[model samples]
Target: MSAPSSRSPVIDTVKGLACMAIVWHHLAFYGPMSDIAQPLAPGLMAFLYDYARMAVQVFLVVGGYLAAASLAPAGTARFAHAGSAIGKRFVRLMVPCAVALVFTVVVSALVRTWMNHPSVPEAPTLAQLVANALMLQDLLGEDALSAGVWYVAIDFQLFSLSVLAWAWVRALPGRWPQQQRAALARGLIVAGAAASLWFFNRVAGLDMWALYFLGAYGLGMLAYWAVQSSRPHGWLAAIVLLGGVALALDFRGRIAVALVAALGLALAQRMQQTHSAGRTLPGWADGLARVGQMSYSVFLVHFGACLLVNAVVGTLWPASAPINALGMVLAFALSLVAGRWMYLRVEQHVPSWATALRWQAGLVGTGLLVALLSNGV
Candidate 1:
């Protein structure tokens, strides 16, 4: 999700919990550690493997909520410069992502020497490196260097699509009234979401594009509008009906998860608005909210951190279930530490085109160098 300029405790709590679920899902899905440790708790491991990835739907909903809040809080485009807004969003997402990719490339190379496992990626080609830097790895059919990187590309595309939609409505001819323009923009989003849930999402081949994921994202956008509307009940009911029909059509578990998350977020915002008189979160919630603030960093760097832990722990105790389980915990802790470092160093800075380009170039350059040295060139 794109980082939000302001914070909501409920949003942060949802994001923080979902971020943890995603990290554990990856650990269970890709591991020598999880493989060996499965015997200790097969049910838990299986649940994590199969169901925890639904946390991604939470992110999609949250991203849409934030996008709506930032771009059109009052149901209309607030800014005139769509290009500059889109460019800024790209730089903000890619600068941290480029740093994470470079780290993962180096980690994969090191793990490849001694750990002969499927999780370790091979040396990159120049084309692959370039494609990844440009966020075209999935579109071009190049393997990603790290887990969850595809989300970054999808996020960029979704934000761009929303920007273009709002801009198009604003540029419509013949001096339409503000209310009419806003209605047109909202209608376009609703149409896109309906198409996605009813058709595009079921195809499975269009996962790389924004259309496939727009249902969840658009629900989030509608949730934001629901919070702003005077008749919140009607808007909330519309959200449920949209997602309910999608589920009735195909019964996707992920869409169900998104629907629940979107409803929860809308309800939470409604409560916060009504009860805004000197309320403060407890200590635990404040801590979780802090984690939510740094979630993008955690999501970016956790894969590499987990890979290194997997290599070390697998080498040390390949068969001890207890030890491997402990290693999983250790990896999760280190991932948080690495994520905090990334957040403070990269994501917090004011992103610029120059800074984004430098990081992108560094990722490609380092990947090419690693490939050359691995091949004895």
Candidate 2:
């Protein structure tokens, strides 16, 4: 195991940049507002629309890296309480996600009333609402209530699967020597990852399942393990070799992106570990790091922000290029502000207060449903 260092500003910076990119992409890729903005810079909007979604790879790799660090920092595969770990992860993700879903539901309904834009989601059904609250929309074959929310479900799946894999390793027969057991555990994990990359990842039919994305997620875990290896060159070489084989088997742009992100994170980890104490980020980088910290909240609320902005802009200007363009910019800026607000006001409170908040949110949702039914809405 390696000694932990201060949080890397670089990772946070990457996250910040990615968050901005995603918001920009969404603003430029969806709705009549984007239609107005597109003519202003068609080429740039097209490129961002086509490619900005790849930023998700960065988050996936980072998630895997952090999961490994928390669950098996030593790569010992000793997960004494995998269930507890999974429960904690679910709460951390779901509490904020559910709250965000409620916001999405309300904003979507408002937009539907104000505009006939293609981007506005339909009035959310009770079943769809329940599925989204549980983050099972993808697996349950329900339409998503919000843009980019599928990633939240995938994040939970990846964490749960990784922990369960470790638990399975821990449950293996006890007669084996400790060293042998550890080696076997690591080998099994690698095997699963390799299978995912070579086989499951190629099956488009399975994309909704956790295993479909596990290939990239596993590459992240492998990156962490490689960086921690005593035989650095050999470990890295093996990682490169395995990744090469996976690509050779079937080239996937997203997987390739994930591999690159994993390598970048590993390199950053190496540099940070080698550096002495007192390493600090410059002012701009520190600002980006703050964005990274609130990236999840930003991601969650940005759709709602965009919807509200679109309704207002459409009412006032109705596709006048300049005003809509300005609205796009306003939407982007306000998303950051709202994301920070949500993070500070809601997400940060989840650790000690999630249970209370969950109940409160449920009651609110129930009351809203009753009122809607009463009005025949």
Candidate 3:
């Protein structure tokens, strides 16, 4: 195995934890809000779990950070090349998203057909499927295949915004001053958050499709690239952490989220300072790293597993809070297994094969294989 770096392994661990928390959240899929509102199992477990959605801010923040760092090298003159950075990023997220979209179309349609809801509200199809396959559902304001899929749009838009922000900083290096780009990020995050709060409170419910999520992502990216790096002067990190929690508790969502994202990225930077590659056998972390590698697939495939499992179990056995919890546990276990399988078989193996296949039969064979797999299967 390649020696694990300071950032990647820790980020992988965080991803694993985030994905697991997401699974727990989705367990409430089939039930009413009252089901969750009436719980306090395992002491404060319910409260902790309920609030864990807050951690997704870390994922968005870290994602932005990594993407920004990748774009901006620590060199002399000129900003990083934008075209190359964006192209590489597009492939990294897009390939798996495409695979997930195709997989969702095939499976959701089958499930809907199986549940005898062939004409039900949530039934899947080829054209609607194509739109999702292209990640344009959110663009067109159409429905989403899954709840979490909207994040794809958020990630894409934030990516463009991050690039623009980077360019803006490069252009106005004077206004940004020395290494205090954190101020710029802080300013953008506050403005975006304020606007988002206004939009959410005054206009309607949580609009993930609106630019708020994108703004959060942009703020996250800005922090990732501009600030939230480098060791603090002193206990500034501790101060930030405390202040973040205080503001969040005071019912400030945007600032709290930005702070949390900053905290996670900053924490990662701090950890990197103390990082050592004790390249012994990887422990519980190895399993978690594998989960991180497959996190995209897990995030994609998990909801299907949960929906199918719940549909089957709820039909055979009456559904309740306890039943929902048990089903969620089972869904997580099954999703992990399935996700790992996809990572190893489809994702990991295909890249090495792509090169060889390109050299041999070239574009003709590649197109044929793509056509066969996408349409034939």
Q: Best candidate, lDDT-wise?
A: 1
Instruction: List candidate 2 stretches off by more than 4 Å.
Output: 1-6, 77-79, 352-377
The 10-residue segment with the lowest total lDDT in model 3: 356-365
| Top-down TM-score ranking | 1, 2, 3
* Whole-model alpha-carbon lDDT for candidate 3: 0.53
What candidate 3 gets wrong by more than 4 Å, as runs, is 1-7, 31-52, 73-81, 114-121, 125-127, 168-206, 209-211, 214-231, 234-250, 253-258, 279-282, 319-325, 346-377
* Model 1 lDDT per residue over 1-377, tens place: 65656688889988889999999999999889999999999999999999999999999999999999999887789877999989988999999999999999999989888898898889999888888898899999998889999999999999999999998888878888888888889888888988888889998999999999999999999999999999888778878888989999999999999999999999998899899746988899887787888999999999999999999999889989999999999999999999999999999888899999999999999999999888989
Residue-level lDDT for 205 in candidate 3? 45
TM-score of each: 0.98, 0.91, 0.68
lDDT of each: 0.91, 0.76, 0.53
In Å, residue 35's CA in model 3 sits off its true spot by 6.8
Number of clashing pairs per prediction, in order: 0, 0, 1
lDDT of 2: 0.76
Q: Name the 10 consecutive residues with the lowest summed lDDT in model 2.
A: 1-10
- In the range 1-377, model 2's lDDT, one tens digit per residue, is 00123255766787888888889889877867788767888998898898888888778777777777777766656456987777777777776666776777777766676688778887666667677777788888888878988998988888888887777767777677667766765676678778888899889998788888877777777777867876666646655766788899888787788878887778777777789647888899999988988888899889989888988887788759888989999999989999998888877774534573574367348536744854578
* Candidate 3 backbone overlaps, count: 1
